[model samples]
Target: MSFNSPLRDEELISKQVFERMVDIVGTSHIVANRREIMSMTEVLNRSAIKYDVPFRIATSGSMGEGFRFEESDMDVMEYPDGFQVIWDHSQNQHKSFSEGEIFVFDGSHSPPGYGLLQILSPEELNSSKLLFVKYGNSYLSSTFWKKTFLNPILGSRIHGPCISSNLECLDFDYAECLISRCWPPMASTFLSRCQLWPNPQTLQDIVNKECHLVPIGHKLGNHEEEEWMISFSLAEKALVYSMNHSQFLLYGLMKLFLKEIINKGLDEEEEILCSYHIKTAIFWTLQQGSSLECCQRNFLKCFWVCFELVTKWVYEGVCPNFFIPENNMFLTKCHGSAQRKLFCRLNAIYDVGPTCILNWLSMQDRSPSLYSYLRGNTNDLYIKELYNELAVFALPRYLNFQTCVRMLKSIVKSAPSNRDGISALVARMTYVSMLQHVAFQLMSLKKEDYTRDNNFDELSCLAIMQTAKLGSVSDLILRAMYSYRVKKYPEALFILKMAKVWLKQPYMIHFGYLDTEYSSEIAACPGNSLLEVVIKSFVFSIKLENPIFYIDELFTEQEHSRKNHWSTIFIPPFVLLLMLEFLCYRHVDTQRAQHALDELFDLMHSNQDSYLTSVFQDISWQILGICQEMAGNLQIALYAYMKSLVEPIVNRIRSATLQRIQSVKRRMCRI
Candidate 1:
């Protein structure tokens, strides 16, 4: 019992205690089955779709990065797939056309005064629901009018000259639609304008891959069209994805500290900082040369370092966006009073030291009790029971399920205070259970007796039953699959159509209340549920191939408003439109084929944010060029081919366009 005893050595005691702490946290905190997490995520997507929640729920934040601890809240980002916000130019002050107003156009004039507008008689307008406008003394064909003027906005028609449709509108709603369609120039010019941090190349690649310019304005009173929030959630996820194991664990530890220790005492009225702010701090810290080795070598030191950075940001009331430094993530939310309170709390925590924190954590009911139980060498029966329960499902082949259960138990123990975290945990649990059920069903089947197809069918049915019980997206897809398998084409088509409607509702909700505070909460459904439904519908329709069935009505205008008075239609996914066009061509229905192509072109024109407009713009033009050539309009076809080669040249496309040009030239020579 001398003062120089080995147990009393300061360095030895510190190492022993901290090392045990690290082991306890690491064993319980780290994501063990990333594959299972991913698979379950996919299952969650299917479930979310089935429920018609428009937001595509994805694992994000610390939980996504795999460093999440028992007390760490889950971060899920909802990407709006079907919902798009276009710049509404008409709302920026524009002239409205009066009934019987006639305007002369030279075909080169910008909208409002540029394009030829023929005022249709009230009767004609009422009966046809079409703008029976004559351009340049010739009644413009419906195709030309649709291609040139009809810009669809949230199931409303925005019509005017193609160049300035937003400038003049017959209806207020139409004007808004027209203005929304004008893609913000800032989005395209973001790389050049904003001084992004770290590597511009890496930032640019992220922007190209997933960055979206949201209509949310940074500053209040700014024109909605002028203000677009450059979202970097995708970029941040990519950065998180690139983190090494140790670095991720450090992030997880920080998140746990924030969620449990920091935010715990804050009142509901308080402007509390979230896990995202902590993540932003970690991102900046890593950018400043904090490495995985630094984290591993000095875990607690790294934790304190991250905590210090977060405190500094909270004190300053300015947490900068990782990609765009100009974007202060905390600018709107973090107030002076809150900042001061947060700074004080952090400083107090720093002054108290690690031992105080450990003591404080141990006192909390929600803190991991397993560590304490182990340390006290008590609760032998309880620990044994827990181990036995886990051991029962701890099959090596089904390790993922066990990992999921461990994660779920940790999540449950954490007792998440937020709705999103709880929802995510529930979703994760549902997915794991569904997966296990399917796995069990498949395992029960004799591999030698059943073919692969039969095994697949049985597994699918099991999955369907599990998902269907929840009454979610996967259920609809499975039901459609069953219908298709049984050759119930029309029934399959109907079910798929219903699924598309469900997929689109979230976007519709978001679109309806663009000005509301909860707009951010309403996200378009992400994932390929709608696309999958469309493809399946197309397959079934093609198999049926009955013109009398009016398959075109279901396929072409699924999102069209049912009310006869409303002429507005949502722009259907171009993939469906493209497939329909191909089907029309296959069936030798030239009129419908031309109509489909025109609609596709109109859609491309109206939706600048559509993936079709960006990546597939050239392909769309090429298809249009070919269609025009077939229609014996060589000049129009040539113009389209040239347009396809216009900026953002794809090499293969250039070569193909040149070949088309030469062929057109040969045809011109023969003519």
Candidate 2:
């Protein structure tokens, strides 16, 4: 019963657990997940700017840290786009933030990790979003700022610093914040600690990045209204990114323990252990570096040590913040009766020993399910994860043309040492961006008679030749979509032919998971190579801004207003390319169109397969229905719409699919 550490004989179990963590961590997928989230948020901010939304949104917390689960709330921080906070009066001349109302950070009276924002620019400012905090010199209030995000309609309520909501499918938590370009003086210890982990480049990147002032005050502080908690969310994400697979898995397991065991056993109000406390423990453990034997062989031992650290923190009544050691994160909560209660709960679990660890890892459904992987064979897990990341890869808004150009310029201007081959995919996207910008210009000008334009013809040809540079099967498919859009049937046919040549090969070029018949083929795909790897990572996503870029199927959904149009609908590259072929052929050759339709039906029908994956399945089916309806096949369109409404898919498109079905029925009545 006195089990404080992994026993000598349990080393075998520790090794097996370590090996299991390897499968669950999915090494390449970890980097891909962070990259995808970062890129996705980048493009989302771009759309927000284009559409005039006031805040730049970023994913934060557990999901932002790169470990996602069914229960994980999608944590987002919304930094007001035009607002800036500077460290001192000397920075008042920092012209880079000229347009925004600036604030001088006043930390003198505030708690260790929190500060007050005093307006430095615009002697007089007025805005409804910020009116609650308006006082002498207009100091921003954490209490007022956090309340602004509340919405009774979305079932949203204040959850600490965030406005938590249960969206249709998932729970979302949005935290309002302001960005301070300079790192805080109190967090300088973190800079010295970075000498061990988070390489020089990553450290530099973290330092250069802005620190956010989240709408959270120290609960015990007097200035609750005006205090803002300093958030190093971006820096923390970078640290998580640098973690080895074992460390990452351990972090995830800690989260699991907090949720399934701790929270499940205690009442909602009594749930004393939070993920942040666990994260602090991990950070403290990680900073131990050479002292801690953090590897596969000692994974369980490391986990146990981290567990002991948490228990120790509870016993001593202090869990220090990772960045600022002066900040006791558990200041009021984990003391006296609360401390005793948490320690007892943890000690009882510790006594359960390997049994507790087994139970923790048993009911998994976080990323890919550690439960089943622990029990069943994992022959196809590698390929399965590749497909999972690829599916998510395609679901972000494509960087707008302007963003691509700016990003390309920034990369070019960066030191040669800073540039890497990863930029090649992005660099080529800049070329496609110019072509895209020109095509949009020509499309708008030649709206009525697009085919007659000589300038459009030149750009169209360039779009065709440069498609490969965009880096996926989307290379051909996006061009084919353009050709079809302009009624260039022969050109669409030529692009489809090239697409078919790529499709016919024995390759892992799928946007979503493949059928069961092809699962083994994917698992045996000879390492999936560099080219396929790039395609899997990028998935050759296309951004469709305005109704002009959308087919008739997606246009109707915009009736909900363009304000919340940041959603990037997931569509598998293979599904999209095939749908485009069907669309193109219907215009040029009835026989070919029918053949394409049949091929699509076969592919969709065989889709119960797990290993071969990606796409917004419902949208893909809905698009099929639209194509069928456009072709005057009312019955087929009706069936496709029905399939879309009923199918198990990622994002629910039920209402839109229902509308399409109703429309199809009305057309059938006409017949």
Question: Which has the greatest lDDT?
Answer: 2
Give lDDT per model, in order.
0.44, 0.64
What's the count of clashing pairs in each model shown? 14, 7
Tens digit of per-residue lDDT, candidate 1, span 1-671: 01234463434433433444444344332233432344344453443353344445444434344442443223333443432322232423453432222222122222111122233223433334333333333221223433433445432432221121111111121111111122233345445543423366665565555433322334332222222243455567767666655566666666667756887777755746876677778777877765534434466566677877887887888787655565577766677777787788888887876533354352233444455645754433232232222221111121232343444344345433543332343343344343443433343445685675565656655654554344443245445544444445556556656755653443222111222232233222234332232222211111111111123223222122122222222222333434334334534556766665665556545663422435345545765666667667798789878887783532124556667788888998899
TM-score of 2: 0.77
Model 1 alpha-carbon miss at residue 135, Å: 28
| Per-residue alpha-carbon lDDT of candidate 2 for residues 162-229, written as tens digits (9 for 90 to 100) | 77775534577877788888888788888887567767888888888888988777888878766888
- What are the RMSD figures for all models against the true structure? 26.7, 5.9
Q: Evaluate candidate 2 by giving its C-alpha RMSD to the native, one decimal.
A: 5.9
